[model samples]
Target: MIGAATFFDGYTVIAIAYAMPVLAKEWSLTPGQIGLILSAGYLGQLFGALFFGWLAERIGRMKVLTFTILLFVAMDVACLFASGAVAMMAFRFIQGIGTGGEVPVASAYVNELIGSKKRGRFFLLYEVMFLLGLVGAGIIGYFLVPVYGWKVMFAVGLVPAALLIPLRFFLFESPRWLASKGRVEEADRIVSRLEQSVIKSGKTLAPVVEMPMAARPNAAQGWRELFKGMYFKRSLVIWAMWFGSYMVANGLITWLPTLYRQHFHLPLETSLAYGFMTSAAGVVAAVICALLIDKVGRRRWYIGALFCAAIPLGLLAATGATTPLQILMMAGLGYAMLQTVTFSLYLYSAELFPTRLRALGTGIGSAWLRLGSAMGPLVVGVAISGAGVHYVFGTFAIVLLITGCITALFAIETKGRVLEELSP
Candidate 1:
């Protein structure tokens, strides 16, 4: 259910990127205006991550997830009615709150459910739905945008509202969250129910092993705790990872369609097709990461991914991003490399803190994600207007290089380590 919700979240978030080409032509939007419209959603996402992350830690994940889904769905409908840049920006900003809030909290919730064995693979496989959602938006945009128009992008986003029913009625709150709150009995009840369901399928259960109790910090201290103790360094590292990866990844993904159409004079179909291909490449890279990250280890995988991405981006800048095919092939590869880092950071972030802080910490860390996401498009706008498109790739390559160095020096490996053991 969470995966399904995120699928729509992915679709709705990137759908605007697909719509931008037509909207730009129709509205005669300046590059700056286009950046503002794109940035608005991500800016809204920053607040949403903070507010909703804090709320989930208090009220529980399921309820907050429900509210977020409803919020974005309604705003998506509102987007269908938007007639200009200002109106679209306003609607997307409001809608971003919902999409932004859902992922990190959902990441925390899902992470808490599984054991250490194959945890990287399991969580990342779930994370792939969001990437698929990006591809879905691109596919929809490729076929539908030219015929049915931009409004159709917003219209298809409405489908996730139906997910609310299953979310509310069928899902239980995170048991690890309950246990952290000292509601041991309630947590045990939910766990027992899961165990019983597994036994009913004729699988024998392993004997329970006692694990070290994770520190339950005062939940009320909230965001302040992130800056104290072991978490302080962890927080900084993850935040840097989130910001650097997202800034480059989203900058490329969101602006590529419009850039192709406006800058290269490609037909609408070709532009959307190129964008979709980039997204598809990212999905493939992400799946490969999902399959192998556990053995490679988190710290090494991230450091390698970051450095690998820098190579293509740096080359693109050195060579000058002159041709459409050149931009697509080089930038697409760079985006795919960063995509692995961006998609898996939630798993890494949640592992960095205890349950008491997991959702909140992930939320706050992802706020940097929102900031980077917002900045990426704006930077692209400024770079294109001033230094030319090649300089955009040059800037991203520098960011990736710095981030890769930081990860190499400081990041800790979390693969196959139990959450409680890793953080505590």
Candidate 2:
């Protein structure tokens, strides 16, 4: 259910971008106008992450998750009624809040549910659904927009709103959250129920062990705590990772089809197909990363992946994207590496903060994600118009290099360690 909710969130973020080429032709929009429309949802996401992240810390994850899903769905419906770019932008920005708010809290919820030993693999398997959502949007747009039109794209979002009723009944609040709120008895009941279900399925439970920092901290953890004392550096580094990764990932993925059609003058079907292929490449990379990440170690895996992604973009920048296949091959590889880092960062972000501030920290860090995501398209637009397409990849290459340095120098290894021990 959590994965499903997040999948919707992922779909909401990218669906409009997929629809952009068609919308631009119908609405007679300039590249600047299209870029604004693309950035609006991400801008809204920045507010949603900061707001919902804070709300989750207070009211709890499940409630915030429920609210965000409903809010975005309502906005999706609103988009269908939009008659122009301004109206569509309005609907998308509000919708962005719902999508943005859900993921960080959801990340915290999933992270809290798993033990650290399997944390990377388990959480990433779930996180992969978000990428699948992106791919799903591309697939849907490829078929639907050219045939049925753009309204059908927003209509796809309505499916999750129907999910809200079942989500409330089927999902429980986080146990770590329950414990942090000092409802230890309630937390124990939930954990005990999970254990019973595991045993009922013919698996023996592992022996429980307590860590030195197992005791819960104060429940009333405010936003200030994210930047205070022990959290300061972690907060800064994770924010940089989120910002740098999304700026490239979302910028490239969201704008690829539109750029392919508008600039390269490919047929609509062919452009959308290429976009779908790019998403497929990322999905394949995500599976590989999920399988090997626990063994590779988070710090080393990130350092290597970031640099690997940069190399292709750097080569593309120098050589130029002369052929459509060449651009797809190079951008697809970089996006694959970026997707690995993008999904893994949630696990990394959640692990860095304690139970009290986990959602908020993740949210704030994700706000940078929104910031970068928003800026990416705008930057791509300006770069394409002013400096040409090659410069856009060149800018991404540099951003990846700086991000790689940050991860190499500052990131800590969290593999095979308990969450409480790592964060607390």
Candidate 3:
């Protein structure tokens, strides 16, 4: 249910990209203005991730996840009443902040609950639903926005907001979190529940390792450990990786609908459908990566997807304002591969650092992610304005190429490694 809650949140935001054209007309927005609106959410995401990441490292992941989701509920509802572009932008930015924190913290929390052998499968299942949220968002915009207007599109956020409160009632503390916090008895209690749930779910588990008495978190050291010594290098690499991927993802996603309509001379409805279909491909890759990550190995997966992605984005750049199908197929591959790499990192970022700064470490990476998201659209928008849309796609191809090379150069493989075994 927590996973279901997150899926809906992801679905809503990505779908909004598809709805931009209608909103732009109804609200009278320009390309540069729309870019700002798209970028604002990520600006908020940066702050939200940093603060909440630190909070999770200190106060605990589950509690912070609940609070953040509830905040998401409130901000999403506020979006329904937004009357102008500025107000709508403000609401979306705040809504994005909530989502930014909710997702990474939740990923760390849930992955910690499940055991190592099945962790890949558990996250895969969770992300599959997350992608479904994208499909649902696209579909909702496709049908409802034509009749009900964009406000109704936002009103639908209520459904997930309602679902979150009840689902959280049954939530438990993360055992890894408890174990790290010196609450071994509590850790055992949660781990037993996890063992039971996995068994009842009919998933196989590895032999359990009894908690060592000495590995618990020391309160005095705090999250500052993330920036000290060896931890700093890992943190920098993860941050660079996340920043690059997010730059590509947001740069494309936020402006994509408008790009389609303008470049291909297509109707709004067709653009929405195209967004839905391609993002669905991304859904497939994300789920597959999550499912196979433990089996395939992270370093190999990251390098392969980055290289594969660069090819399509280059092709997309070469397509140069062709038919909708051409644009969709070319750009869709980039989107899907981007998502594959992105989802793989959800676990990777958290896995890279030691237990003490797991959230902070991931948060540090996500901070750059939001920065990328914030800047990507703005930069791409300028590229389109100064040159042509072809130049923008070509530029993105270069970015992807750089991203792939960097991934090959820097990332460490962490397949099948124990969570606490990761060092600072």
The local distance difference test score of each candidate is: 0.93, 0.91, 0.77
Candidate 1: tens digits of C-alpha lDDT, residues 1-424: 8899989989988999999999999999999999999999999999999999999999999888999899999999999999899999999999999888998899999999988889999999999999999999999999999999899999999988775556578899999899877799999999999999999999988888688665566657878989998899999999999999999999999999999999999999999999999999999999999999999999999999999999999999999989999999999999998999999999999999988889999999999999999999999999999889999999999999999999999999998887878777
Candidate 1's displacement at residue 47, Å, is: 0.3
Off by over 4 Å in 2: 213-221
- Candidate with the greatest lDDT versus the true structure: 1
The numbered model that scores best in TM-score is 1
TM-score winner, 2 or 3:
2
Candidate 1 minimal-lDDT segment of 10 residues:
212-221
lDDT of 3: 0.77
323-373 per-residue lDDT for model 3 (tens digits): 667768887888898888776577788778766677877876888888998
The local distance difference test score of model 2 is: 0.91
**Better TM-score candidate (1, 2):** 1
In order of listing, the candidates' clash counts read 0, 0, 1
Off by over 4 Å in 1: 218-220
Report the C-alpha lDDT of model 2 over 260-332, residue by residue, as the tens digit.
9999999999999999999989999998989899999999999999999999999889998777889999999
